[model samples]
Target: MSLLKKFATVASGTLMSRIFGFTREMLMAAFLGTGPVADAFNTAFRFPNTFRRLFAEGAFNAAFVPLFAKEIEQNGMDGAKRFSEEVFGVLFTILLGLTIAMELSMPFLVSTVIAPGFTSDPVKFENTVNLAMIMFPYLACMSLAAMMGGMLNSLHKYFAAAIAPVFLNFILIGALLLAWAQNYDPLQIGYALSWGVMAAGVVQLAIVWFAVRRAGIKIGFRRPKLTPNVRRLLVLALPAAITGGITQINLLINTNIASGSAGAVSSLVYADRFYQLPLGVVGIAVATVLLPELSRALRGGHMQEAGNLQNRSVEFTLFLTLPAAAALLVFSEPLVRLLFERGQFGPESTLIVSQILAVYGLGLPAFVLIKAFIPGFFAREDTRTPMIFAGISVVVNVTLALILFPRLGPTGIATAEITAGWVNAILLLSVLIWRKHWDYDAGLIRRIPRLIIAAAIMAAALYFSAQYFETYLSRQAGLLVQATTLGLLVIGSMIVYFATVFAIGGASLSALKGNMRRRKKAAATPENTDISA
Candidate 1:
């Protein structure tokens, strides 16, 4: 299948999952709002969620897919299956041990590291620690799921893995509804939600596991051994894991800073959810498909093909990212209100969340671009350089956060993150260019200006449109009215943005349509090999 089509599939699924995730968070807002229990739940949830994202989307995929793809290309299906089983065995064992350790230490972690501010309120601290322990098993399930997902993506079977995340939100929604039906207290609801997270992890893993088996590959467990391939994978994955986990690490740093303020952790969580929808859909979809494709291209010595892919990937990223970023920056308050400001989620929560969301918007494009660039290094198994760059970004993020938090509050934390994102993106791009691994093409140079222009135009329109809807947003308008007004604003902005892009000759309707279509020839696979692989 074409990379464009594969990306669409992954993005489409992610779009669905994010929509479900949106609904799930909306329900949580109604069920708990930014109350102490909500704060506790979000705080406890952050640790597992951070590492899960890295394992599922970043670190594991980076190190595993390229090597897994190479195994298939060289040694065929049998070799690939054997390698996968061995990797799974080792990964599962490690995940189990880690889960146990985290569960044992979650209380200490919550008190000292994860949510130190909650400690001042003994109830909040105790609840967070308890909730965190309940969800700790999710780490194991997600780690195994990541292994399965990497294998599926490497084989070009993206649907099941892509859709697995929906289960997490769906299960949480069900749990919340059930809790409401039972009139469970907020703390009870929090525990229910935590268990729901663990359940979803198992469900996610099972679906992908069956999908792999259905594809005629049976993954079985064996005694963990340090086979040469496993050792090599660990060597590559350890640093890649750390590099790929920069987002989580930065969040941890920001969480440390945000934890000093009551409700700040939950505030960042809710605000980030809005932008993560776009990030997951556009940036992650492209990155998921790009990694294996780049690995194959580079392994076969097709630099031209690899370079062209990188350029198109960047173009695709900016085209979607710019509009989303503009909307977040311009319409963040209304969007936050339209979606979240109901029940116990009052105006104060809306305002604070919107501020963070806007700051987050400033770095949205950088976030997507970083995802686009990282594959160049990972495709060549060069994880350590990105690790160095990530370390620098972390230092920058933490230093800035410490300096700004006292003055600006949670907005300051968001600001540090955006700055760090840009730093990481710039460093990654410079190294890629210096190493002759990547450079911008004319297509990129021409297209980016138009994107910026389109986004600027959209931002102005959205700002004005938001003013029109301000009364509906603020005066406790009914859900339908708010939905309609927000919907119109969104639809109108999109129309203007695309029209501007097309008129400026920044994008081609025909080329985009054609790119979405399947070509008559199948993409070339890596040359079959006889090496042990």
Candidate 2:
């Protein structure tokens, strides 16, 4: 398939998941609000999620996908299957052992590192620890699921893994509904969500396991053993675990810092959800496709094609992310209030979340661009470079968080993150440029400024729309009225953004549609047998 088609497939599935995610968040806001329960739940969820990203999705995929893809591209099906099963066996064993240890030590960890601030309040501290223990086993399920997902994505089976997150959103939404229906208190609602998280992981694992089976790979339990391939995989993965985890590390820091304030962690989580909508749909989808595709291209000695794919991935990422950043920056308040203000989430909650959302907006493009650029290193099977840069970014983040959190509150946490994002992105781009791995294509270079200009124009339009609709949005209107006003602002801004992009020559309608046409041609092309350089 063409790169664009692959991207579209992944993106379409992510779009479904993101839509469901929005519904999930909307329900959460209603049920939890910006209260102690909300803070506790977010803290608990962040613990496993941090490790899930650190070891499972981020590091494992960066190292695993390229090697697995090469195996498939060269040695064919059986070779790939053996490699996968071995990795799967090792991953499962490790996760099981780690989950047990963490569960046992949950209290001390929570009291010391995870949420020290909660300790002064016994209720919050106990709730956070209990909720985290219930949810922590989810890391085991999701870690295996993430490996299965990488396997699926390597095989171009994007739908199953992409849609697995939808199951999570649905499960949590159901849990929230059950809590409401039972007239459960905030603490009980936290329990519901915690159980829902573990259940969702099991479901997600099953979905992708079935997908890998249908794709002609069946992996079963085996005694853990580090064969040569497994050892090599671990070697490549260790640095990547740290490299891919910088963002999450920053988030963990922010969570700890936010814990000092009552509802600050919840505020950060809510704002992050909105930012991730665009980041997931565009940046992550692009990154997922780019890994296997670029690995294949590079292995086949298609340097020109490799360069073309990288450039286009960046173009595509920014094409969507730039406008998204603009929308969030301008319409954060209205969107937050419209989506979340109906229940216990009052104007104060809306104000806090919206402020963080706008600050996160400043970092949206950088976030996506990092997603685009990191593959340049990963696809080359060179993770050490990114690890160094990640280390630098981490230092920048921790320092800034320490300096800012005391003064600016949760907004300071958001600021630290964006500043660190730019630091990571700049370092990545500089390394790629310095190594001559990514030379800016004239076409891409010419379009970036135009894209920025178009975004500026769109931002101005959104500002005016938000100003005009401010009074209506601020009133104690019903959900329907607020949603309608917010929808108009969104729809209008999208129209203006796309129109301005086309007018300014940032992207062409024809080039995008041409990708659709070329998809067929790409499928017909002979497979390149050169799978190793």
> Residues 160-269, candidate 2, lDDT per residue (tens digit)?
88888889899999998898899999889999999999999999999998999999998877678999989989988988888777788889888887788899999999
TM-score, every prediction:
0.97, 0.97
Off-target runs (Cα >4 Å) in candidate 1 are 523-533
Could you give the C-alpha RMSD of every candidate to the true structure, in order shown?
A: 4.1, 3.3
Count clashing residue pairs in model 2. Answer: 0
Model 1 residue 496 lDDT?
Answer: 95
Candidate 2: residue 49 lDDT (0-100): 94
lDDT of 1 by residue, 206-286 (tens): 999999998778988878998998998998887788788888888977887788788888899999899899899998898
User: Per-model C-alpha lDDT, please?
Assistant: 0.86, 0.86
Residue 502 C-alpha lDDT in model 1: 81
